[model samples]
Target: MTNATAPLDFIRPEVDRALQRFVDRRRTAFDDPDLAAVLGTVRDFLAGGKRLRPAFCYWGWRAAGGADDPGVISAASALELLQASALVHDDVMDSSDMRRGMPSAHRRFEKLHVDSGWHGSAVQFGEGAAILVGNLLLIWSGELWRNSGLPAESLASAQPVFDHMLTELMNGQYLDLLAQAHGENSFESARRVALFKSGKYSVEHPLRLGMILAAQSREAWIDQVCAGYGQNVGIAFQLRDDVLGVFGDPAETGKPAGDDLREGKRTMLIARTLELASPAQAQSVRALVGDPKLDAEGVATLRTVIEDTGALASAEELITTYVKEAVAVLDAAPIEAEAREALKALAIAATTRRN
Candidate 1:
């Protein structure tokens, strides 16, 4: 189902109001007219995301019995700002020109280069501009969190979780880069990447941070439970993304079909395919995987080969396993019955999402 019709659609509107305020404040800080363009880029990048991270933060606070405090709202909104920073950087790293069916921040800058007839290499200009904008978003995210009207103790308690999330994200990005370079997309390696990159930051840490800010007495146990839930949901999310990358309709996904094959992403599906392929099939798959020149027909061939080897089924099975485990974790948590049921629904929705 579309996010507009999803159960949590109301949360997105609330978050959007906060985000617009944040963006206005951001634009007011700069005196240079050119900087307005930069701020506009940031605004565009922040728009249209699923806002899943912030929603998780909100739910975590509720699960811990936090009141609907303004501070909680601000803190949750900061998560989306942080996510925008990451996505801008990630798009640059991935050499992705388009995001959410529009030019990425870097690509927009590059296009301005050509449109304005600016001197120098557009590629370098775009990369440099996008990096600075990403940094700005990161800094503002921290500022939002610090100024969220939370008590000093609450802020202090949540700081470490936020810090570790960013650190882990960087480390996870590095691991993904290394894995890509070394062609080492084993199941174990992919699991680690998912945990550090998406699981912790995308799900667990956000939840834990909200819980910490709420000053829940069972924070320790809750953190563990959140981690387990995040691990399962995060991996499931990534696996679905991989499937979408290779097999989804381009019109719906807003990404080129087989983009992952073109980028040579060493996903779990690819790893499993290689492990289970017959000798000749394995050789054919290996030859096509990292070749930048692999065409649409080649990608289709590879997809068929992968499916024939049962890798697709294996990946789907793993997703089911993780989702089941995550449900169990939530079931055992000490949350209020109503909040627990809502959290369970969220878990199911996140893991079973089609887009």
Candidate 2:
């Protein structure tokens, strides 16, 4: 690939600068110290993500012959705000205690309530404050995107995609909740949840938004890329995440070991395990998977069940198949050479990371 710049090195600092400037400007508009604490917590949470969405957006623009432009960088950086908003809300939804090795937004707010001896239920206060913080980030994302200095026509062209992505995300989130409520554990149901909840927004829409902004119109090839390469990579990316949620170290993943098991997330891995497990194995999983007090021993037991069921191997194979198909599409795509190489590397990075 001839030393193509890694997106983390090339794009993250610029995105960080844009985010910092946005935060500074917003700080001036709000004077309350309590609000400042909320803002600061969100800001710190923003600092830790891999910045992969912006990277995909940038490469998609590049693939469409877009030049280096600060306007586009600013526009792409808005995705980080959108991501932060999702994570803060997601942590609350999952009741996750930590994020990026620190207290999650809700937990932090809950602690604040307790420490300050607030006159209300600390748990409710924390969750309410985190929801407001998430909403604030969502509002700021729109503001940043609209003010990104891109041409009005380009932004206008991409507006529908940007809007649709958010709609899809909300729909996916609700579907996920519904699946959990109903105890739906079929692989097909799990795949549906993965596709809408994380896959499409994480990859496909970001790529489409970037390409549409650059091309200033929809193209047949853009749709093809999104549907083929984008879709596969997105699903594979989420699958890889499901694996990490089970097997990754807390020091690296920034959540408790087997956090997904504790959350009772109906992920593809869990679905696959149930499909392959013996009656006793399935029974053990059913008993242990949703227990909030799952300790290292419980985690170890579930890990053994998942491993012995061959579900882990099956999920890994699926990830490989998806990545291979995505790469094959990229190989035949008529795009900029740098973008082609970068996209290939991105596919590997997305699916193979330990955390």
Cα lDDT tens digits for candidate 2, 206-292: 888888999999889998987798899999999999999999988999988999999989999999999999999999998888789
Tens digit of per-residue lDDT, candidate 1, span 1-355: 2332353574688788888888887666776877877977887877777777887787788878787887788888999989888878987887876677778889899988888899999999999999999999899899989998888888887888889889999998888778789984677887788678777788888878877788644356877878788778888878877787788887676666777787777777788888899999888888888777778899999999989999999888988898889889988888656556666666666666655
Name the 10 consecutive residues with the lowest summed lDDT in model 2. Answer: 1-10
In terms of lDDT, which candidate is strongest? 2
Q: Tell me the RMSD of model 2 versus the true structure.
A: 1.2
Clashes of each: 0, 0
Candidate 2 local lDDT, residue 56: 88
In model 1, residue pairs whose N, Cα or C atoms come closer than 3 Å (at least 3 residues apart or on different chains), thus clashing, are: none
